[model samples]
Target: MEPLVQDGEAVAIEQEAPGDVAARDMLLDRAMGPRWRKKTSQKIRQGRRPADGLAFVARSADGGLAATVRLWNIEAGIDPFGRPVPALLLGPLAIDPALKGCGVGAALMRHAIAEAARLGHGAVLLVGDAPYYERFGFTCAKTGAIALPGPVERERFLAVELVEGWLDGAAGMVVPTGRYVTKSRVRATAIAA
Candidate 1:
């Protein structure tokens, strides 16, 4: 995909690659710090990849990683009527400290949301600053009744319905519904090694 030009800079949005893993993690560390590992979002992402075709990074004109965003498959638990509501969890949208307010994060959000709509996804839930995400159409109006498995500032839990009414009456705990990577788990034998 061609990079989007904002403020005379080319910010390319592309699928995150296997080769980008180390750099991605490092950028995340720099952006989020060690405390990132202790968040409720970390628990949901601990052993899974982003939802298929939903992981993306913003690269600077020189090809350095500038920002990252990931979406994960999750259940908004069961709705009020007891039907399961499939949804995507968007989070940890980390932008390089140096690139904050450079429009990289906004570009990533637009691209991801557009892609998700194209892929027929319904709703997206996230824990984020309402003022920041509200620009992308996320609102607490849809998330008022939803909860996370761990402690979170209730006001920060927000949702956006890619499909109208997707979040209507959908309320419950959000849980990881994607493939959990077992390869990263250290077995007892490996622990002794």
Candidate 2:
């Protein structure tokens, strides 16, 4: 991904690396506060690996983490016939408090969304501010019939289809379908349950 320049600072967007784990977690905590782990999205992500090649981060010119976003594999819902609807769940897109509104978050979002499309994902679901995500083509148009495992503000549920009509008839409860992380890895990562 390309570096984004904002207010004379250059922030490079890149794939999340092993070394970025601690920094990313700290950044997320700082940006979202301690309660972020209890969100409904976390329930779906617990014990699962982010979809392959979908986790990303932004680093400032000083090499400090600036922002992060990740997409998880999920079943949006089962169709009437009962087959799981495969989709991507995006969440916890956090930017360092200092970097908020500096375009780092936007850059990372664009990169992640484009990469997901490149990887042939059909759609992306998220619970977020409709105003912010709408700029990325996300809306609740197709998410009305979809349900998460826990409570979420109705207006906050959103989706954007990469392949036109991929979510046309999607309905039922959204469920985690990503590869499970090993117990040891989960313990090391301390993934929120």
Top lDDT model: 2
RMSD of each: 3.4, 1.8
For model 1, residues 1-193, the per-residue Cα lDDT tens digits are 8888867878899998766777877888899887887899778877776899999999889988889999999988777789989999997899999878888899899999999999999999898899999999988888777778799998898889999998888877888988865664424213432
- What is the lDDT for 64 in model 1? 86
User: lDDT, candidate 1, residue 66?
Assistant: 89
Q: In model 1, where is the ten-residue run with the lowest total lDDT?
A: 184-193
Compared with the true structure, all predictions reach lDDT values of: 0.85, 0.91
What clash pairs does model 1 have? none
- Over 1-193, each residue of candidate 2 has an lDDT whose tens digit, in order, gives 5678988998998889977887888898999997888999999998788999999998899999999999999999876777888999998899999888888888899999999999999999999999999999999999989999999999999999999988888899999999998888767677532
Candidate 1: stretches off by over 4 Å: 182-193
Candidate 1, overall lDDT? 0.85
**C-alpha TM-scores of all predictions:** 0.91, 0.95
The collision pairs in model 2 are: none
